[model samples]
Target: MMDAREGRRVAGQRAEGVAARYLQSRGVRILKRNVHSRGGELDLIGMDQEVLVFFEVRYRGSGSLTGGAESIGYHKQQRLLKAAAFYLHRHSLWNHPSRIDVVAIAPGITSQYRVQWIKDAIQASP
Candidate 1:
């Protein structure tokens, strides 16, 4: 049997995959995933026309936003913002319109996981 930690990791990965598929289905062009820099790490990055979106993928076993979206507290938001800035500057996309978004996935027993997309989820200066 897998350990609790491993199980959680697997679940999180599944959630991220779901988030990726969901975004792709919505016609958001994916740019990158798990981008790492000196500032921080960004879970996913995508483009929606002129807007460059930085996404944070989260998973909870409940059907509410409380589990995943709420997990992105203020500090986490700050880090994500900084990370987005780093990514933009590195890729010379600083002039592009950019925003932060959250994709919350909640696993279920008999049904597929639920996903919620929050556009412009965080407001912090780059």
Candidate 2:
């Protein structure tokens, strides 16, 4: 991979770590990390309040104009949706209530790692 691509991968991993920590702090139980399926790859999977949670971790380096959330385009969303379905079926939970979440991380000075957790980010077909 090129330098930019490598950097992006590293940043995404950092974002996932931050997101997982943040979710854990909120009492969410992590079930899996980097789960891949027909839909796409889910960065993190957890349980929160009796609901299955699928998370997408996005990160933007310092000095970047757009924030992390903006990086998640429509294609990414569609993949995540399909991935969620795959996960559900693989786990044999067709009727369980589930949700998708987005965790945006903006790394900067002072402390770095600014996180934004968006709940119910995307809806999956039933």
Candidate 3:
């Protein structure tokens, strides 16, 4: 039997798959998934045309009160910034056009899942 943690992990993976397909349909070429840096884990990384996009995939069940996007608090944003920075520096793409995107997922009435792609969702500190 799967514990709650494991169940959640599986659900998250499913959500990430959905997000990746949705993004690909929109012309995003996914470079990697579940990339972990010293700071944190990046759910998905892709190129949206010339822009390097770092995606954070968030999933919320139908019963959940807080939506997926709402769950990304300030602290989470900071961690994502750090992770994205590490990736950019490591790849020597620090000066390249890049942005953080959020893929918010939830159960849908008409489809399997509803996906919202928020571009330039996280702004780094100056």
Candidate 4:
């Protein structure tokens, strides 16, 4: 019997998996998933052709008040930015083009899930 937290975690993992598959179908080659750094955890890391992409997979159940992408507040965005920076520096890939993307998932009527892939969804402060 999974507790509420565990159940949520499992569901989140499933959502990520679904998002990964969806992205792959659209030509995103996933390199990693659930990557953790000192700043925060990155949901997915992949390459879209020549660019490196850091994907944030957000899943909102049918009953949730906030939508998937809408749930990410300013603080969360900052953490994601920092995590992406850490990843880039660690891999010495600063020269490569990179951007943060969001894969927002929600319950769908006609399909199992509604997925919206927003490109370059997060940007660092100038």
Candidate 5:
């Protein structure tokens, strides 16, 4: 039997996969998934035309109280920004245009999931 943690991990991976496919259909080319840096983990990374996109994937069960996107609070946004910065500095991609995006997954009425893709979901702290 899968443990709770393992189940959650599997669910997250599934959500990311769904999100990636949805983005691809909409013209985003995915470059990476599950990128782990010193600060945090990035669920997906892609390119939308000239802009590099860093994606944060959030999944919520059908019965959960908090919506998937709503769960990414202030601290989570900070961590994601830190991770994005680390990725940019490490890859020497600072000169490229980049933005953070969020893919929120939840149960849908007719389909398996309803995905909400928010562009420039979180801005870097100034």
Candidate 6:
């Protein structure tokens, strides 16, 4: 039997895979998956045309109280931003346009999972 942590990790990997395929079908070229840095981790990194995209993949089971997107609270967003910045600095892509996107996955009626892609979902406060 799989332990709770292992089960959750597997589920998250599956969701990230699904999100990657879904994005690829929509013209986003995936660059990397599970990018970890000192700051934080980026679930998926891709290019949407000329812009670099940092994707945060969130999955929620059918019985969960909170939706997938809603679970990304303030601290989570800050971490994502920090991670994205670290990625940019490491790659020297500061001049390149970039945005943070969220891919929320939930149980679907017809499909095994339903995906909601929110482009530029989180922005840095000015």
Q: In candidate 2, which residue pairs clash? A: 39-83
Residue ranges of candidate 6 with Cα displaced over 4 Å: none
Report every candidate's CA lDDT: 0.86, 0.86, 0.95, 0.96, 0.95, 0.97
Candidate 4 — which residues are off by over 4 angstroms? none
User: Which order, best to worst by TM-score?
Assistant: 6, 4, 3, 5, 2, 1
Which is the winner by lDDT between candidate 5 and candidate 6? Answer: 6
Q: Write the per-residue lDDT of candidate 5 for residues 77-102, one digit (tens) a residue.
A: 99999999999999999999999999
Alpha-carbon error at 75 in model 5, in Å?
1.3
Question: Candidate 5, clashing residue pairs?
Answer: none
* lDDT tens per residue, model 4, 26-88: 999999999998989999999999999999999999999999999999999999999999999
Against the hidden reference, what TM-scores do the models get? 0.87, 0.88, 0.97, 0.98, 0.97, 0.98
Q: lDDT of candidate 3?
A: 0.95
| Clashing pairs in model 1, backbone N/Cα/C closer than 3 A | none
What tens digits encode model 3's per-residue C-alpha lDDT throughout 20-109? 999999999999999998989999999999999999999998899998889999999999999999999999998999999999999999
Task: Estimate the TM-score for candidate 5.
Answer: 0.97
Clashes of each: 0, 1, 0, 0, 0, 0
Candidate 2, 116: how far from true, in Å? 0.6
**Relative to the unseen true structure, what is the C-alpha lDDT of residue 77 in candidate 6, on a scale of 0 to 100?**
94
Compare candidates 1 and 2 on lDDT and give the better one: 1
* Steric clash pairs (candidate 3): none
Per-residue alpha-carbon lDDT of candidate 2 for residues 1-126, written as tens digits (9 for 90 to 100)? 569889878767877888899899999999999997767899999999899999988877777788877887788888998898898899898799999998888875667667888898777546
Residue 28 miss distance in model 2 (angstroms): 0.8
